[model samples]
Target: MGTAATDDAGSATRALIFALVALACGHMLSTLLRTIPAISLDLMAADFHIEPQALASLTSVYHFAFAAAQIPVGAAMDRFGVRPVSLALLAGTVFGAVASGFATGPESFAVGQLMLGVATSGMLMCPMTLAAKQLSAARFGLWSGAILSIGNIGMLLSSSPLAFVVDTWGWRAGFWISAAGGVVVALAVFALVPNQPAEHKDHSSPMAQMIEVLRLGLSRPLRGLIALALVSLASSLVLRGLWGGPWLMEIKGLTRVEAGNQLGAFTLAMIVGPLLIGMIDRRIGRRRQRGCREHSTDRRRHIERAGGGSLRRTDCALDDGGHGSVVAPRAGLVLSGRAFRRPSPAIAGDRCRRSDPQLHELLRFAGRRC
Candidate 1:
């Protein structure tokens, strides 16, 4: 009987991991879609009768939309649960990707980008929330890294492979392919992610909840950290996903393939660097000081500060956006992974009584045994 029970537990763990990975692939799709314009900006601009820089700047709308939607998306996941929210987003992504592929004008493409931005804003959070609520902190930490590592793989695909596709079939092929991928991921989520509701639901109006988040974030004590996160996130996205290609191709006079290769190398480093820092963190048990000294770690993760917490506990932003852009993906998984230490005794009591679901959720992620 005992052996059979162990086998059952192992099977459940496997199923849970499959669901987690499928959800993580949504994060991959998010990165892939967001960065698509980087490689093909010139072509897209020419097709739309505009300057390449204009098209590049227009892509910023997507990022703005993405950032804005994260505020509501987290609440939706909390209220409606991750599985439903993920399915809805995946559906939107598929439609948006296909529409973008079919777009013949700048206006249509902009509309498509907006849809995609909102749809994919929570891709990382979906998986992160799932792991946070379902598993022990240790397992959640391991899986969090896995989520980052997997999600960034989309950037890798967007690099050389996407360049090749653009050269051969024109840039539209990328979106069509992504649409297909979205359908596949959606099916996987439907099949694998458990259909359970959130353990603690917040039934309050979303606007009130959002107001609470904004108020907390903008409060005097936390505003500095929020400002720092915003600065760090925007710079990294613009650097890696926007101008990096133009610099390589136009300024350096490299071929498209060559530029993709260069970006691929840098992205590979982006994927590997964080986990290395995280490992050193584990060994020495002192990452916060180093994180501050380097000024190149995850601000949100630092804010969490849970003892032995998962590496880079993040929320209300895209996964990569939550980390130090330089070393974002590389360190996510030795295998997969909060810095928010437990609340103070006074704050902890308030958290239990408050309807501010994020605070309640935050407290639940406190590091504990499986």
Candidate 2:
């Protein structure tokens, strides 16, 4: 009997691991979708008949919508189970990818970004809330690291691979492929994640959960953390997603392919950071708060603080640094210097020539005169 019980426990552990992996893939998809614009901003702007800066600024809507959705998405997870909420978000994500892929103008593209924002807002939390509920601190620490490592693969994908796809097939192809990836991820979640009941016993209305999240954001404990997240993450997102590729290509005189290679290499350290920390946390393991009652506020705070200590990257949406990440992209234009924003009329005319031969010739002649 003892052997049989041990086997069952092992089976359950394997199943949970599989489920978290599937959910983490959703986070990967989120990373891929959001960062694609970074490598191909110029291409997207040319296609949309706008300046690169405009498109970079416009894309901030995705982050805003992402931040705003955190409240309702959290509430939905509380009222409904993580699996259902995740599945719904995945479906929405696929739909948004398709919409973004087919967009004919900036208006349509922004609509798609808004959809993606709402859809992907909850992805990091699904695997996280589940692990936080089920695993001991040591176990959760290890798994959280694994989940982040998986998600960082998305940024890696967006870098060189996406740049190649954009250069060869155009920016639309990138979104089309991502849409297909989203479908695959959804199927994996549907198959691997079991139909579990809502683990949170919050009888409070969904509205209450939403309100509570806002309240906590303002509360003293989290305020400084939130601001620090803002400054650090905002700069990183803007640098990586908004200006890094362009800066390299425009200022450093590197080819798009070369720029992609450098950017891709730069992300390697981030992918590994979490695993190292998780290893240390596992070495300094904590006792069980895995099945502790959340009937009391103190226990809830204890788990939030303790879990956040090592696993903050599970990214609590707000903690994901949404506000700052989006807001900082515009500032990137200023910091990157003048070459990118105005891009000498010659360069603009050269890019515009793809769609208009006459204008390209005119710009070339005009460039000689200047």
Candidate 3:
């Protein structure tokens, strides 16, 4: 039994690791799509005889489609598991990248962007769901951080490395390369990542769970967390998706290659941030635990002082006289039992007297008369 258990644990760990890697791949592809346009924005603008805003709209269309699909894609991930959904999305990404490379006008470019957005939506959620399902709670944080860091590398590559690819063989060549890579990653995910097992098949309807999620979000803490996440994500998206490349080219006056290199550095920093935060969290967690213990002790002491240096105990008593009393040992007083009696105090007193032999014997004649 022990050996079997160990083997099972090992299998689960391996699955979790693979899932993280697959998540990294998905993220890499998404980031690639995101960054490629920025690197080639100038070329795109000049080629299409449009202003920067028009070319930028192409990227925005992709973002809108990607963001819009998140909730539904999450639901699909819950129902069907990561493998099939991820594989399908990856295939879409490849097709979108290839199509975008060949697009001749703004309209065709927008269509490609929308397609890429729809396809890459799966990339964001599936790996996370897979990790949550397969990994132990203790390890989830580490794996999540690892996956995010790895995925950021894709963004990094999209910057400097993509610039190199474009510089060598032109922007079209870069897209073709990305499409080929996407296809390869998709194949890997299909081959290696585990899908939902029969025993763990989803029992609840997707609509029900989605509704529950909506309901839960109405609570204050959930709402707050969601709001905070949205704000942070908005800031990040604006910085990376909109401003990063422009800042490099316009403000820094760097060539596309030099600008891409600068953008790569920014992406590298993003990749490193999670790792640094993880390490800080680990270190701070230990300190936080100790602080919590000390705080608990201080709270206990404060409570003791508030009660005159002694803890108070309260007790209820029912006497033979058919009376109930609330006795506070610290206060040295007993509350009248009238409030506790369901019927008349007289009736309760008589019953209490009858039930207690010591009190009954002491007032036997009186009891008999009653």
TM-score of each: 0.80, 0.75, 0.71
User: What is candidate 1's lDDT per residue for 160-253, written digit by digit as tens?
Assistant: 9988999899899999999999999999999999998876576689887777767765644343344445554565577568777777888779
Best by TM-score: 1
Sorted on lDDT, best first, the list reads 1, 2, 3
| Alpha-carbon local distance difference test for all models | 0.73, 0.73, 0.65
Candidate 1 lDDT trough over 10 residues, lowest sum: 332-341
Q: Point out where model 3 deviates above 4 Å.
A: 1-8, 198-210, 217-219, 282-370
lDDT of 3 by residue, 12-34 (tens): 77876776696678887887777
Q: After superposition, how far is residue 273 of candidate 3 from its true place, in Å?
A: 1.2
**Each prediction's number of clashing residue pairs:** 23, 0, 4
- Candidate 3 lands at a TM-score of 0.71
C-alpha displacement of 347 in model 1, angstroms?
4.2
Of 2 and 3, the candidate ranking higher by lDDT: 2
Per-residue alpha-carbon lDDT of model 2 for 1-370, expressed as tens digits? 9999999999999999999999999999998899888788888899899999899888999999998998798778867888899999999999999999999999999999999999999988888777766776457767878888888888899889988998899888888898999999999999999888875546787777778767755644334334434443665577566788888898779888788888888667668866765666436432112111111222233334334542243236445453333333333222323211222454353365565333332222211111
Tell me the spans in candidate 2 whose CA falls farther than 4 Å from its real position: 281-370
